[model samples]
Target chain A: MPRPAKKPRKSYHHGDLRNALLTAAREVLEERGPSFLGLREISRRVGVSAPSAYHHFPSRDAIALGLAEQGAAELATCLAAAPANPSGSLLTYGEAYIAFVRANPALYRLMFGEGFPAVSQHSAAIRALRERSYDIMKAGLEQRLPASELPIAGLFLWALVHGLGLLLVDRQIVRDGDLEDIIRRVLTLAGTGLLHGRGRDDGQSGPPPPPPGTRSA
Target chain B: MPRPAKKPRKSYHHGDLRNALLTAAREVLEERGPSFLGLREISRRVGVSAPSAYHHFPSRDAIALGLAEQGAAELATCLAAAPANPSGSLLTYGEAYIAFVRANPALYRLMFGEGFPAVSQHSAAIRALRERSYDIMKAGLEQRLPASELPIAGLFLWALVHGLGLLLVDRQIVRDGDLEDIIRRVLTLAGTGLLHGRGRDDGQSGPPPPPPGTRSA
Candidate 1:
C-alpha cells in the first residue's frame, strides 16, 4: 500500500561527506529556498550518489538541521562582536542582527522559520549553537532588567528586533536610507518604553513633536 | 529551448468556482502544508479538471494570495474584538493574536511566511484586506502615543507582539499556564519601559524578586 523508503548505498568512511553535504545544503538554501531543497539535488551538486548522501542526512529535515546550525553559528559571530557596554552594545547587536537577516534571508528563514526541526529533534551540537546565540542576548538584557523581569524583557526585546527584521525582509515596510535610524529609535523605545527621560538621551526622542510635516520611517 | 507554459483549457464561467476552490485550498493548507499545495490536487478534490482549476487560479501563487486574504480577514476579526481601553485592549489583542497563530500555524505561515507573493503583487482586494488589519492596530496606538510618534510606536508594538507570537508558536520559549499574565507584563513593559511607575502600577512590578526557588518562563 505504501512505497519503501530509500536507503543509502555504497557506505564508506568518508569523514568529509557530512561537511560536504552541509556546504551543498547551505548553497541550495541561499540560491533557491527551503522548498527547493532536496537530498538528490544536494548529492548531484556534491558529485556523490544519493545513497552516500543519505549516510549523513536520512531525510531533508536532517539536512535542514545542519543548515540551521550553520546559521546559528554565523549569528553568534555577529552578536559576539557587540560592544562591551550593555545598553549601547544592544543597539549595535540589534543592527548587526537585523542586517544579518536582511543579507541572508533564505538562510535566516531556514534557521528561524517554520518547518525547521524542533528542540527535541535538534542534535547536541545544533542545540548548543542555538543557545549560544540566545545567551548573548540574555547576557545583555540582564544588565538592563531586574532579575524578576529578565525573561519577559528578553522575550519583548527579541520579538521587537526579530519582528522588525522580518517585516523589512518581507517588504511590508520600506525603509529608504534610515534603517539604522529606525533601529535606534525602535530599540531605544523598547529599552525604556518612553519617549522622554532616559530614552531621550539616545537622540531618538524629543519633547517637541515634529513641526507638522517631518516624519520618521 | 524550453517547454511552453501550460494554458488553462476551455475557459467558461463557473458561478461559485472561485469560492469553492479557496475553501478547498484552505482545507489542504490546514491538513498538509504550503509545499503540498497543487492546483491539480485541489482540482481532483473538487471534482474539477485541471484546466477548470486554472480558470479560477492561474498559478499556485494566485491561490496562495487567496488563502492569505482569508488569513488576514480572520486576524482582523480577532483584533476588532479587542476591549475599548487602548492599553488594556492591546494586551487582549496580543493574546488573541498569539492564540490565532498557534491555532492555525500552517495558515498563518501561508499568510506571513516567505514564498508568498509580495505586497506590490497583491490585487486591490488583497491589499485593502491586509491594510484593514493593520489599521486596527494603528487606531489603537493613536489613543496612547503622540501623533508624531504614532508610526514608530505602532511599528514597535507590532513587532513586539508579532515576535512574541512567532516565538511562542515556534516553541523557542515555553510559557506555562496563564499566557495572558505574560502578555500583559510584556506589553506594559513595551509601553512604559519600566518595571515601576507605569509598568509597575499595573500590579506586575515589585521591588522584591521572585521567591528563591521560583522561576519565570
Candidate 2:
C-alpha cells in the first residue's frame, strides 16, 4: 500500500475562515479582552497571512461588528427557545436574555460594549437583527400584559436582564457556592409582581428604603 | 482703562491647565466623538498648545479615560441625588437614571459606550466613586430586603438603572411624547418586583415581547 499520507497540514483556509475569525476574535475578547485583540494575531493563530484575514473582516472594528451581529442572532435564539408553558412569551424572552448574557458573557459584552460603536451605527444587518429581536420581545409581551403596558414592560425586562448580564460578566455579582441561587432569587424578584402588589400603601410609590446607619423596624 | 481690560486669559500653570484640558476634552468628546477626538483639537478648544494637552492626557485614549472617569463621577452624583423616601427610592433611582441619560446623551454614551472601558481599572478616584454608588444601591436594598438578598438586590437595581440608562440614551426605549410616563411605568414595575418576579416561576428566565410570527396560548 502507498505510504499513509500525512494528515493535510491544517488547511490554510480553515475551511470557513470568516466564522473562524469570529470564533478566534471571541476567544481573544473573552480571554484577554478587546484591548489585546489584534487582526494579525488572529491570522497568525489561523496560520494565514495577515492580509488574508482582511478578506473576512475589513478591519478590527469590522470583526467586532460581525461579533455583535452574531450576538443579536444568538439573543434571538435565546428568546425563541424559552420555556413553552409560561403565561407570557415576553417573560420567557426576558429569562432567556439573562441566561444568554450569563452563558456567553464575552459575546454579550461585544453586543453592547463601547469598542463596537460602529456595530450600532453602520451595520444594516446588525441593526435589522436587533430591531427584529426587539419586535419579538414586544410580541412576546402581548400574551399577558395589556397593549399599553408593552413598552414599559419591554423596557423594564430589558434593563433587568442586561444589568444582570453586566454584573455577572464583570464579576460584580459573584457568589462562590450559591451562584444560581442568587440569580434565581433575583429572577423571582424581577419576573413576579410579588413586591409591588403587596405592601401597597396606596401604591403611588412606596417609601425609600431606610437610610444607611439607621435601625431597622 | 484700556490697559486694565484683558484679564490675561487667566494664565494657568500645569495644575490648573489639567482642569482646563479636562473640561475642553469633554467638550470635544461630546461634540466630535472618539474617532475624531485629538490633541490638537482639544488644545485649540482650550486655547493651549497641543503639547499642553499631552501633559494632562498622554494620548487620545488617555483623554477618553479621563472623560470616562468624569462621566462616572457624574453618574455617582446623579444616583446620589435621587429621593430618599422608602417607597420611592428604588423607583426614583430608575427615573433619575433615565433623566440623566436623556439630558446628557453623548456624554452618557462616552461614559459606557463602546471602545470606552469601565473606569474602575483606569482611575482610583473613579473606581472609588463607582464603588460608593454601588454601596448606595447595596445599602438601600439592605434596608428593604433580607440581609442574604441585599447584594443581589443591589446588582439587580443597579442593572435596572444602568441598563435603562443605556437603552434610553440610545433610543432603544423610545421616549416620544410624555416620556416621563413611560419611565414611571418602568420604575413601578421594577420597584414592585414585577420585572423580576411576575409569573411565580423562577426556574426559567424572562422573555421579550412575542413578535408577529410567534403564537402563544
Candidate 3:
C-alpha cells in the first residue's frame, strides 16, 4: 500500500507543525538554494527532533513541493486580481510579478524551479491557475492580434514579463529604476506596432511569418 | 584605514585562488541564496583554509561581486558575438540568456542578485553590452518609430528576452518551447505594429496621442 499519512501520527495537531516547517524551509531557502536544504535542517530550526519532523513532511521533496504549490496558488491569485482591462493588465502584470518574486523569493524559486509543476498532468489546480495568467495574455492576444499570430505573441509577452520579474526580484534591475515606467513603455511599444497613427492591424497587412523554434530549451 | 592586505600565506606560485573561490562559490550559490553564503563555507569546500581565501577575496560579498562580474562579462560576449540583424540578435540573445542561466544558474543568480553589480550603474563595458542589445531593438524601431520611442522599444525587447530566459532557466515556461519562433513573431508584431495589424504606427506619420503610462513606467 502507499505510505500511510505522516501527519497526526501521535495527535491530530498537524497544522501548527505544518506552518512551522514551511516557515523554517523559507529560512533555509533564504540562506541557501533549495538543493542544499534538508528536512533535518528545518527540523533543527523548528526545535523538533529530526524524525519527529517527518510527521508533517513525509520527505524533503514533499515539503518543497508543498511550498511550490502554495506559491503557484498565490501567483495565480496575484495575476487573477490584476486590473479589469487588458491595457491595465498589461501595465500591472510586471509590477505584480516583480512584487511576488521580491516578497517570496524562495517560494518563487520553488514555484519556477526545475521541479516546476508540469502542465500536462500532475496537478489540476496549479495548471488552471497557471493557465489563467496565460488566459489574460490570450485574451489580449485574441483581441489585439490575429489568430495566426497567437503562439508567438503569447510567448513573447510571457517572456518579457517573466524576465523582467526575475531581474526585479534578483535586484539585477533595481526598483528605484522606475520599473513601472519601463514596463508600461515596453507594453505600449509592443501593443502599438511601430506605426501608431495608422492603427487596427488585422494581420493581412503585414508579411506572413512562421512560429518560433521547435525546441526552446 | 582599510584593513591591511592579508599576506599571501600559501604557495607563491601565484596559482589562482580567485578562480577556485568562484567555483566553490558557484557550488554555494546553487545550494542557497545571497545573504547567508559564507567565504568560510566555500573555502572549506575548496580545501583551502578560510583565512587564505581572504588574501584573494576580502569578503563573501567580494566573491559574490566577482561572480556577478564574470556572468555579465560572459553575457556581454555572447551578445557581442551575435549577428547584427534584429532577427539574428533576437534568436542569439534568447539562446544566450537561456544558456547562461541553465549552464550556470548560480552565476546567473549572482549576476542579478542584491548588493551585487547594480545594473543601472553598469560599468562602461556592461553598459555598452546592455545598450548593444537595446540598440538592436532601437534599430528596428528607428525604421518606423521615432528616436523618442527607442527607450520603450529597448525595454520591450529586453523584457521579452529576459522573461524567456528566466522561464527557460527556471523551467516555469518550457525548457524546449518554441523560443526562436517566439522571438521572430514578437519582433514582427512589435516591428510592424500590434499583432492585430490594427494600425499603422510609423512615427513619421504623426505622433498621435501617446498612451498615458507609456513613458511613466
Candidate 4:
C-alpha cells in the first residue's frame, strides 16, 4: 500500500517552475494549513533545489502572497458566476461566497491574511480582487438598499457570509440536520430581520435573561 | 531601549511552574503567533530545561489547548458582563464580543483553533465555554424570535457578530469613519432586516447587474 517516492526533476523550463512550485505550495497549504507553508518545504515537494525555488519566490511570505492572489481571483470568479438573484436578496451571492470558502478553506484564510500578515499589505492585486468580490455584493445591495445604507449594509452582508463560511469550514457549527438547509435559513434571516422591528427605534425593551454558567472574569 | 534578558530560573516549586510556563507561552503566542509556538521555544523563553517544561505540558499542542481554555473562559466572562440589552437587541453583547477579540487578537485566533488543529478536536472545556457564549446569544434571541426560529436565528446572529469581529480584528474593513459607529450601524441592520420583507416570500425580483471586471474561472 506504500506509494513510491517522487523523482526529482533536473530542471524546469522557463514558466513551468513557477507554476509547479505554486501547485506544490497549494497542496501544502491545503494539507497542513498556512502555518506549515515554507519555501523550503514547497521546493522539496516540487523536487527542486532551494535556489531554483528562490527564483520564483523570494521568501515564504511571497509564496503566501502568490497563493492569496490566486485565491482572490478564483473567489471573484465564483461570486460572479453565482446566478444573479432576481428577488433583490443577497442569498445567492452569500451561497456562492460561502461555497468558495468551503471548497478552498485554507486558501480563503490565506487570502484574508490569516498566517502571512504581509499578504494583506503588500498585494495590490489581492486587494483589487477582494474589492471586486465586495462589488458583487454591493451590486446586489444597490438595487434594494438606499444610497446612504449601502456601505454598512454591504459590510453587514459581508460579515455574515464571511463568519458563516468560517464557522462552517472550522467545523464550529454543530450540525443536527442538512447543512444546506441551515445556510438557507440563516441567509433568509438576513433578508428578513431576526426581530419584528424594521428600524433602530423599535420599542422592544427588556433586560436579556442571564446566560447560563456565568463566571467572573 | 533594549530590555534586560531574562535569567534562567534556578528552580520552581509545585504549581508555580505550570503557571510560569503558561505565562511565557502566552507571551510567545502574542509576539510570534501560534505557528511560532513550540515547547522548546517556550522553555527557552521561561529559562527552563525542556524536561522541566514538559513536566507541565506533554507537548506544544497541550500548551496551545491550555491557552485556548484560558481564552474561552475570558471571552465568556467578557460576554456575560456586557450590560444586557433591555430592548431585546444583542448590540451590547456583539460589542463586548468584538472588543474582546480586538483586545486579544492572537489569543482569540488560537482559541478558535487557528494554527492548532487538534485543539478544537481535543478540548471539552473549550467546547463547553463556546456553547456558553452561544447560549448568551441564544438567550437574547429567545426574547424576540419564536422557538422554531431560534436555531437559525442564533446561528445568524452568531455568524454576524463572529464575522464582524474577525473582519475588524483582521483589518479587513477599511476604516473611513468611526469604527464604533460602523459596528452599531451593522448590528442595527441585523435587528431590522436589510430589506422590507418580514419573511422569505417577498416578491421583489430582477436579474442582478453583472459584476464589474467579470473574469472567466
lDDT of the candidates, in the order given: 0.65, 0.64, 0.57, 0.74
Report lDDT (Cα) of residue B94, candidate 1. Answer: 67
Model 4 residue runs over 4 Å out of place are A1-15, A120-122, A194-217, B1-15, B194-217
User: lDDT value for candidate 4?
Assistant: 0.74
By descending TM-score, how would the candidates be arranged?
Answer: 4, 1, 2, 3
lDDT of 2 by residue, B1-217 (tens): 1222112454354336666667777667667665456778877776667886666666666777777776666767767876766656677666656666666666666665445454424467766777877776555544455443455566677778777777765556545767666667767777677333434432334444332321111
Q: Model 2: residues >4 Å from true position, as ranges?
A: A1-17, A47-60, A87-95, A135-141, A174-177, A194-217, B1-15, B34-44, B47-62, B113-123, B137-149, B175-177, B194-217
Better model by DockQ: candidate 1 vs candidate 3: 3
Per-prediction DockQ:
0.23, 0.26, 0.25, 0.38
Evaluate model 2: give its TM-score: 0.73
The C-alpha stretches of model 3 lying farther than 4 A from their native spots are A1-15, A23-51, A59-62, A83-106, A113-129, A143-146, A172-181, A193-217, B1-14, B20-51, B59-61, B86-106, B113-145, B173-179, B193-217
DockQ of 1: 0.23
Candidate 3 lDDT over A42-69, as tens digits, reads 8777666778767776667777777767
lDDT of 3 by residue, B85-177 (tens): 543334444444455556665555455533343322355655555555455434433443444555555556566666666555544555365
User: What tens digits encode model 1's per-residue C-alpha lDDT throughout B1-217?
Assistant: 2211122425344456777777778888888776567787777666567778777677777888888877888888888886757546566666667778888877877776765544225667766776787778778766665676666677777787778777766666655747767776777667565221222122212122111110110
**Candidate 2: CAPRI quality band:** acceptable
- State the weakest 10-residue window (summed lDDT) of model 4 chain B: B208-217
Which 10-residue window in model 2 chain B sums to the lowest lDDT? B208-217
| TM-score of every candidate relative to the true structure | 0.75, 0.73, 0.62, 0.84
Query: Per-residue lDDT of A174-213 in model 2, one digit per residue for the tens?
Result: 4576866666666666766433433333347454322222
Q: Candidate 2, residue A14: CA error in Å?
A: 8.5
> Residue B3 in model 3: shift from native, Å?
30
